[model samples]
Target: MGEIWMIGATGRAGRNISAELQADRHRIVLVGRNGQRLAEAAAAIAALGGPPPRTLVTDDPLAQIATGRPDVVVNTVGPFGATTVPTAHACVAAGSHYVDLANEFQPVQSLLGLDPAARTAGSTLVTGAGFGTLATEALVSELCAGRPSPIRVRVAAMPVVDGLGPAVLASVVDAAATGGLVYRDGRLTRSRLGAHLQHTPLPDGTMRATVAVPTGELEAALNASGAGDVIATSSEVPTGRIARVALPIVGAVLRVEAVRRTVIRLIDRWQLTPPATPGEVSWAYASTEWEGGETRQAWLQAGEGYAFTSRVAAMVATRLADGDARPGAFTPGALFGADLARSAGATITLDSNAKDLR
Candidate 1:
């Protein structure tokens, strides 16, 4: 059991992470912008078992975190693109391991650049511990587990659930609007978003989403700590048609500096979407294919994406606490076996269209 200073403890992923960590006998220090809300999270964590770590509410919680010097710091306070650098530095300075659930690629890359500094400080700094990179990366890596050459890897992730926060949505738009980054013909290249749409079979029938570019983290993992030429794509489809209609508009707001910053400020002002409602449930379906002469593929279903990510992150943190993890910037796919992703409870299946090997 380790002590965790959870920075966004009252948020959706934070609450879920707190639950997962508590189940493992780790202590949780719930920190949020609200004292009442943090206290509530603390109470719920306490009920889960071994006395909860202290709950502290402060805008600059790192000062408080430095004082406690907990074993781990889970920064569920995203957007990672905005907060990872500072939080990672603080964790290193405090001699605590750092984990986050950010969906953006830029910030994750930033964290990777800090590897040497973190090691010098004797702390492990991990990014993409959550859905944006880890789960999807893990799913894709597992699809081609033991294969070698002449392999073609393709991924299509479609998100269907409550809307992503503007920052997250922007990350998708930024990658999409920028163009597609595909590992085609054994090399990485760029194309446009919405240009790679495919009709995939879903329980409700054929569902559609564009095969967008791969995240830097995903590219690194699929390439095996940056080795193979694996093509990857990620996309978002509205859970409801209304959200679909609003996506372009939201994407627009993100493109403009004033609107983008305003939206971020709004997130900070509200402290959360839906004004203190932490009930965030997200879902996604990922279909992947790996082919040498024959093809093997799988459809991965995560009923509630963020909820599952929180669990994955907690599990990673657990491994780190016990010195069971490698120190550096990483994704679960880069570390775990196929069973690692499966044991966490995602629905996995062999692609039906897979042709006969013989």
Candidate 2:
């Protein structure tokens, strides 16, 4: 069994991924800031008839990781803009594989930029191992397969999450502060936040409103389709008319370093009410246009977002631990192909005819 260490072991995604790894009989070490919470998470795992997990309470997880050097590290901590690069660097230095559920634009691009270092260290680092990036990225990959480079690509993520967390809120603030970004002529371009508002159609024959947001899915789509122009949209953000008018102003205000930090600090202390359970299905949509106006569209249908994220993170970490991945840095689907989504309990549908891309 591979030795796997889970950072933020007490959080929702961490706990779920821990259970998944336990079911596969891998050895897990729970790492967190609170000793009691870590112990409780370990106890919950043992209560499921699995072996007791080792728990490590440390304020400095990077030092612990560098010292212990587990075979694989799964980082569930968010504001991944701050956590992903440092943790992945530590893992590379320690010669361990790394995986994280980061869907922010900067962090995802920065992590993927570590490909040379990871290859030199013989370590695999996978980022965006979650619904937002993988769900749409996988579809783009499928639609672009066996085709020449597309001229334009658009991807939309519409996940149904059951709850919110402080870290999630903080990440949103960080993303908003970064403003909106799109790929134009193979270059990253800045745009107004909440631009390109779209009334996207779902597989269920209903329409959901989405707005362009700078997200990792944008970078992932560009890489997957080799498109000269790419834009990523999401339904997670407020997309109403009022929000559209206000988003650019809000983004501009948040761009102030002090204001952004202050907002994030307050968000960290928020005790938000748990949201109602998500609907039965979530969908990620992507449409690609080739040089001569040949266009292809696809969608990936899955269950609740959090459960799918847990599964994807767990599967990616497990595969990395098993030496099934190449020594480099990549987004999940970029490393494992579209099949990674299928393995994580998502189904892909291609074209207007609803042909299955399984």
Candidate 3:
């Protein structure tokens, strides 16, 4: 097996992915800024039934990826808006495949924009290799298959997370600062943050009040379905009646650049904990309405968020390492199809019986 280097190897998601990749018998090189934490993570991986992964402590990740020349580099670092481009470029330069667990809008779009370069360099770059984007994207792909371009596509991500770290909080704040966006008439347009609230029904016989968020799925859905209108939402936002009333007001404040930065810093410094533990199952839902009045919906159910994310990241990296992926920048679904999501433990269900194509 070729050596795979994982950045942010000590992070929660990074450690889990490391163990999974190790279980597949892949040689892992743990890369992180802290030596002690990396050692501990390596030990944990070793305990999981693999030889201790080689560890590299480095502040300059790009330089290390270039010099070490691993077959694949998995980036688990957050605030990927800042990390994705540089790291992906380094991978291209080193002729190494790159994958990141990024679901943020800017990073996902930014990474995809590098497709020409990645193809030229003969390296595959994949973003949103996590539950946040993959599940929804896969559903969109499934629904739109063999159908005319959809006029509208709506997607929602409802994940059950056991915990949230300060970094996750910071990422949310950063997304809020990006405000809301959706694809309309085949072009991206801005919308108010937390706008367009809806009670999204899950396949598990329940509904969650979701609000529009500028998630990477918005772009992925548009690409997958060729939809002229797209709205990406999430159940992560506050959904109560009172909370819904106040969200727009809060979003207004967050839209201010300085205020957003201050909020992120405060959240980071205080290390705020999320209020509740999410449920055991996570879901991704999407509905598409086509030009001929045909409508279709699909659902993806998976285990808890972080564990699912680990599975997805490992699966994508494994595929790339084994030469299953072609040279291009892609999301997991766009590259490997919805089956990859299923292989990583997501149950997919499509609803087309009620829709008439004729």
Note the clash tally of each candidate. Answer: 2, 0, 0
lDDT of each: 0.62, 0.90, 0.86
Which candidate tops lDDT?
2
At residue 344, give the lDDT of candidate 3. 92
Off by over 4 Å in 2: 272-277, 352-358
Ranking by TM-score: 2, 3, 1
Best TM-score goes to which candidate?
A: 2
Candidate 3: stretches off by over 4 Å: 255-262, 265-269, 353-358
Q: What does the lDDT read for residue 232 in candidate 2? A: 95
Higher-lDDT candidate of 2 and 3? 2
Q: Please state every model's RMSD to the true fold in angstroms.
A: 4.9, 2.6, 2.4
Task: For candidate 2, give the lDDT.
Answer: 0.90
TM-score of each: 0.78, 0.96, 0.94
Candidate 2 residue-wise lDDT, 1-358, digit = tens: 5799999999888999999998888889999999999999999988877789999999999999899999999998878988999999999999999999989899999999999999999999999999999999999999988989989999999988888677777788889999999999999999999999887777777787889998999999999999999999998888888989999999999999999888878777774333444677888999888776677789899999989999999999888888798899999999999999999999998884432221
TM-score of candidate 1 versus the correct structure, residues matched by position: 0.78
Q: Sort by lDDT, best first: what order?
A: 2, 3, 1
Q: Write model 1 residue lDDT over 1-358, tens digit each, in one string.
A: 6777788888767888889988888766888789999888888888888876578889887787677787888887655666788888888888888887765556666788888888788888877776556555665565555655424545555544443444454344444333445566556565443344445445445554544444654454445423344544454533344654554455545667676666667656764442121233222334333453455555666645656677788887787777675555555666665455566666666654644221
Where model 1 places Cα greater than 4 Å from the true spot, the runs are 65-67, 149-151, 159-190, 201-208, 213-217, 225-231, 238-253, 268-294, 351-358
